[model samples]
Target: MGLNGFSFYNFPTAIELEYHQPLDKFEKEINEENILYGDKGRAYLKIFFDF
Candidate 1:
């Protein structure tokens, strides 16, 4: 999470990472899914990646 060129902080895990641009009209926007990585069918990978 950062504004400008300054970094705020890194996510504790790679799978937990997300990048969302800020906008006033985005309050109702749904987060797009990454099914290959976020779906439960491949949940084993979470352990493999130490999530």
Candidate 2:
């Protein structure tokens, strides 16, 4: 099996986030610590598939 003349075209979009200075440190630590952390915050993304 092989990828024959195949290519990936992704159009992923997300909400551009703005963070407060002090909270940026916490965000970094949370990301480093655990994936389950940062339950209080929210993020956004959208994707579409085409053929």
Candidate 3:
């Protein structure tokens, strides 16, 4: 399940692995570059709406 009752139909192991390791490293690099260049950090969107 995701945020606010949103759920995934099927989650594969690869998705989990990417989140834990490679994606984390990638985010760190991006953040460091932004900081060094005096740029703002990246922002993501998460919507939570139920009908």
* Candidate maximizing TM-score: 3
The Cα error of candidate 2 at residue 31, in Å, is: 36
Candidate 1 vs candidate 2, lDDT winner: 2
The C-alpha stretches of model 3 lying farther than 4 A from their native spots are 1-40
Worst 10 residues of 3 by lDDT: 12-21
TM-score of each: 0.16, 0.18, 0.19
* Candidate 3 per-residue lDDT over residues 1-51, each given as its tens digit: 222334445532122111111223222356457323323344334543332
lDDT per model vs. reference: 0.30, 0.37, 0.32
**Clashing pairs for predicted structure model 2, backbone only:** none
Q: Order of all candidates by lDDT, from best down to worst?
A: 2, 3, 1
- Give candidates' CA RMSD values in order: 14.3, 13.4, 11.5
Model 1 spans with C-alpha error above 4 angstroms: 1-14, 24-51
Tens digits of per-residue lDDT for model 1, 1-51: 422222335533333323444343212324774333222221112211223
